[model samples]
Target: MTTIAPSRPLTAAGYPRGFKWGVSTSSYQIEGGHDADGRLPSIWDTRCRMQGKIANGDTGDVACDHYHRYPEDIALMKGLGLDVYRFSVAWPRVLPKGKGRVNQKGLDFYDRLIDGVLEAGIEPWLCLYHWDLPQALDDLGGWPARDSAGWFADYAALCCQRYGDRVKHWATFNEFAVFTLFGYCIDWSAPGITDREAHLKAIHHVNLAHGMGVDVIRDLVPGAVVGAVHNRQVVWPEKDTDADRRAAALLDAHWNKAFPDPQLLGHYPDLIAESIAPYVKAGDMAQICRRTDWFGLNHYGPIFAKDDPNATWGFHWGAAPDDADKSDIGWPIWPAAFRDELIGLTKTYKLPIYVTENGMGGNDKVDDKGEVNDATRIRYLTLYTDAMKEAIAAGADVRGYYVWSLLDNFEWGTGYQNRFGLVHVDYETQKRTAKASYAWYRDYIKAARAAE
Candidate 1:
């Protein structure tokens, strides 16, 4: 027993009136009907089929089984009393071969999903792309190809025509940098390539896709609240030296400014501007910089960077100090950095921000009495949310907060070793166990709204 403490009473904490709260989950992470109902292979599916790409040989072949059990999961969301539920639509699901032919079976799955989410009294936030690009599209050059933008736009049009009526909260993509950087440069994620040209091309094309997708959604879906989720984390130097400083600055540009800067501000950062210029044709910036409704920030913690001549882009991921505070998954935990990011993000972007994903991974274990009391996760949420409140008080126009996930599904790269969910999922029996943080968030939302 980790010594369960008494639950605290609700307090307003001065959160603004109608500060929305919810949870976020992606398609491949949870929905594991990999081969069912005309669904085809995504880049992730191809990666999983490759040897030694994912940890522990874990494939999302049966991840949390959300495809089969979403109704039960909707009941879970209803029980939580959320204002909205954020999830991504798998591209390969609706467009089995990327584009051209529509898979009505795949389209019908989301129809039922959106209907169930609405019936549960929770608004559905549909994200168009969460990096599960159709493998057929990858076969045709993936995000590195300029045509990928058009492909994504066609996919967006199909989704808008299908479920745009109920899904008013539309996000074009989720964590653009993560998928592009990891997939093309880092070789840690799907479509694992390490070519510099591929990385830059993927970055530009993905941003172009976002803008095109936004245009399609706005044209098709009336009154659509459109945004794109970007994982914006502060980049820290691995050391205090000039080499480390330069590396951190470049990584910062790629991590923070790559997609959002081009998509929102109309230009690439100076660090990679020249390198990416070859791919930029006339008026491409105008096309990439489409107007969006909100900025979806998916932040976790600060990322460390160091100069690496042998690594991609002349820099590689570095390590935090031995004594630095870390999450269960070894990610550095500095809620103050999170607080500062929120404030800076608000000032820089000047858009209503919604934290689409924020949560910590935990080593959740089912107790002997069939309970998962993940106190560590609860503490992480408290710290982050309190930091967010501080940012809100300091004049950040942050409207909503959605936790990273609803269930502990297949964490990319690390597999299921990292569990970032309010509800714990037992991989063995496919059981969903609400952790202590779930109740905490439920009450937190209640109190924030009650204050109004």
Candidate 2:
């Protein structure tokens, strides 16, 4: 048995007063009943139907049944003493065809969810997109087409008009690099299309859509705080050689700076400028560059890059040193790197930072007494939160920290194989059992609040 230490006070841990603590979840990952409430198919629903596309051939047909049991989930969030709940709204649910007709039932669902969140005294942080693009939009060329910007703006406008009164914190999109590069360039995710040119086009269109979405939300919702979330990574070279160093720099440009730089700095990185120049048009930069209220960062760990002359991008991801501790997903546990990444973002963007999504997937299982002893996850949270406190003390203006998930839902591509949740869910019965980590988090938040 893994022994968990007693909870330490956050003041002693150095977390500042009013440090927002919350949990995050995406729509398709948790809210199954995929065809519920007049909703149409998304790219992910289609992808899961393809042979061997998802692990174990598992589809999110009834993932945790959050669509029907959200009240229970909200109760779970309340129990955790969460200050906020960060969730994404499914595009297909709101607009079956991605445009033209509005689905009142879809809007009504979020209407109730938002009300429940507010009733629980937790702030609602709504992310407009979380990679579940409507299949209707995919049919119309999806993010690769220039028209996607308009489609996305329309969706955002509708959402703002309906939920704006309650939701003040809005994120335009989540992890553009992952969806564009993996979905279009590498063929790992939905609407998978492995083409370099298409990848570049999709990247530009997504950026345009983000800027357009921001404008729509600001125009439609009074007092709306809008921003975009990027899966930021600190790229490190595997060896002290010029080739590896160059590869690391290139990877950093594409993986880290590509989406954010255009949005925040109004220009593309010099390393990738020429390659993406063909798709850039006049006034696009001006449109992409908008004042954001905060910079949402979803960090996991650093990526080790190495020179691979034959690789499509002239860089390949290498394994971390064998001696390093790794998460269940094989991601390295590097808290110092996490701190440095936050400090670096503060130095560059000068916007308030939100650790929007940070957690470790664990090989969690229920014991005979029907409790999950996720001590490893608890440990991961402690170390990472401590690192975040260090970054804040080092001059990073971090306003909040939200763990990746509140419940064990469907993990994309990996299906339900990887679990990253404070509350464990039984796939067979849809039963939620709060793990040791949940108790740890609740106590930590209580201590933090009491200290304040």
Candidate 3:
């Protein structure tokens, strides 16, 4: 007795057979009761205490209260006719000290969560780490510390040894670029630091941590499929000038290629070394080169670059030239660039790719009809899917598409202000209302299935 809209009468655009439709979410962003069931403080917990760090002084302490409402959430996913559920496991919850011991209660929660998803007939795509470094680890030098990599490996093994049988799809880390750059260099996120030296050190260690985690998971789960999640900005130049193009190349090296190069090519991007040479150590590159089963790209929008010597990162972002579609988040809705990114990565790495996260954030509210018909979000989803279809037709080995979120939850720093969910969550009442985007997506997938 699942609930969904009637399939629309429309011809389906050809997509690769067996292309998956799934929804994604993260631990800290959605799951509340931060200290419940033996969970301990994470770096995010400490960051939340810093005044002026988050908008509206928001914290994920009670986000969506998913800790108490997961069964209902799973039922909603079943209603969406989703094939997979991509979610993250909070590190501190499992390893309170980040390394020394395991908390049975913490592991029990995910054990139940996975079992529930499986009972709902949804494949579990578990992400090992998603920016929630245990507070104990941060106290021990955080990701910049070489020991943190080993600690992560231990934790990954622990999770796999326990739950690998039920979790078929695994992702090592989600968006290392955003965590390292925004958290360290920009000091905009948790455990904030703005030192260039710390940034480079954290970058190498994060890469090594990902590799070690993958190796551990592979050992524990003999048949588990592994990938690393990344949010890559498809960079574009503002003009045809050589300087602008050069800036775009640099932007791509830092934003898109840095995270994937070592895992796939056994080396960091050349421009990475050139840009951060002063802070690199002798054998850091060798430590980062670990093979992965797949490359997960979490693309949202493209960044237009122009040469700017005075810019903080030696590059500037320009607004999209054309405005055929735009999200309430002010992001351009360009589907063409999405295809280009897939093809670009395919040519560069020649590996299987999955669109791990893609969706639009909007100002959403239920109307008089008790319907959250967010037409703008629906349009964004359609155009983005069209982009994915084009890439598949062009022979890109793209495997699946997981929408950015399952529920409107705590968006970091912005807090609950930015809503990026197919289902809207009223923060006060904790009510789940499916939006127009959700209804449209259900129809789209059903049409695709009917066409098959």
Candidate 3's C-alpha runs over 4 A off are 1-13, 237-247, 274-287, 306-312, 316-324
| Candidate 3: Cα lDDT at 37 | 84
The lDDT for every candidate, in the order shown, is: 0.89, 0.90, 0.84
Which ten-residue region of model 3 has the weakest summed lDDT?
1-10
Q: Report the error of model 2 at residue 18, Å.
A: 1.8
RMSD of each: 5.0, 4.4, 5.4
Q: After best superposition, candidate 2 residue 118: deviation in angstroms?
A: 0.5
> Which pairs of residues collide in candidate 3?
none
So what's the TM-score on candidate 2?
0.96
Global local distance difference test of model 2? 0.90
Rank candidates, lDDT, best first.
Answer: 2, 1, 3
TM-score of 1: 0.97
lDDT of model 3 at position 91: 92
